[model samples]
Target: MKWYSLMPGILLLGLAGCQNFPALYSSAKPQITTEKIEQLSEYGAKFATEYNRAAQKTCTKYTRLYQQGDWRAGWVLALQVSATNNKHCLDNTAAIQILETLESQKKIDPELLWLTQVHLNWLKELEQQTKSVSQLKRAANRKQSRVNELVKENQDLVEKLEALKAIETSINQ
Candidate 1:
């Protein structure tokens, strides 16, 4: 009887010691670059920084306006930044709609004209087709976001199915 009692105690002690092993966890975090649109945006930013100082300035302006909650100005600057070869505005979705609105109305800002012409002469050298680079990047980002959302929805469905299976197992038992 004593030996039997000791056996239980020994087993419990062994298990208690084994449980002290360090808990294992995932070592990697999800990254934005894994998403196609984010990768494209990064590529665009890198490419643009090589040639355009205006785009860099525009990114700074966009960040400032975004932080200040000046959504309109932020969008404008975001669009300008996206126009560069690097698509620096990929992170900001709100700016795309704002830029689209400004474009459809045929309302060009005299200030932008003056800034591009006199102050930032590099913009003047761009062809007419190149001017729409920001718009294209915005469109691409939107598409990528939609794809990401769909993937999330699918993952949620899988999780729900797993939960349902667990509930069924417990109920059946």
Candidate 2:
């Protein structure tokens, strides 16, 4: 019927009207400024430093746990620490790259430029530390796996030796 056809059209029109199509289609870009970039870089550096510090603490705790034979928990903690460190590196790298790009495009103040360079150097150091931590985590996991395997093999050997003794005792009886 005509009413049913009109209902669908009306619903479609109402749905379209509810959506802010103009806002979605607008081509306006956010204004970028040197001050904003500097602030962002500073914040990024602070965040990275905090994250790295926390990760280091976690790593230390897990290292102690690992020494105490809680390998599974230690391994999981190590992986989490590695991931946190990696994320810090990624975030700082992105902020540094953005600042570098801005510097190339516009004239940044000497103070801001110096600060950016300092942040870049710090991020680089963090990256190196992250890499070292990851390497150590991997090595520890490998060693733990080897130790687990040796313990399992020893248990099997002991069980087999017990069975052999039992058989010998039955034959003598």
- Predicted structure with the largest lDDT when compared to the true one: 2
TM-score of each: 0.28, 0.45
Summed over model 1, clashes come to 2
lDDT, residue 95, model 2 = 45
lDDT string for model 2 (61-84, tens) is 544654575533222332232253
> Residue 88 of model 2: what lDDT?
24
Mark the regions of model 1 whose C-alpha exceeds 4 Å error after superposition. 1-125
Q: After superposition, how far is residue 22 of candidate 1 from its true place, in Å?
A: 98
lDDT of 1 by residue, 47-71 (tens): 3554266655656665676567554
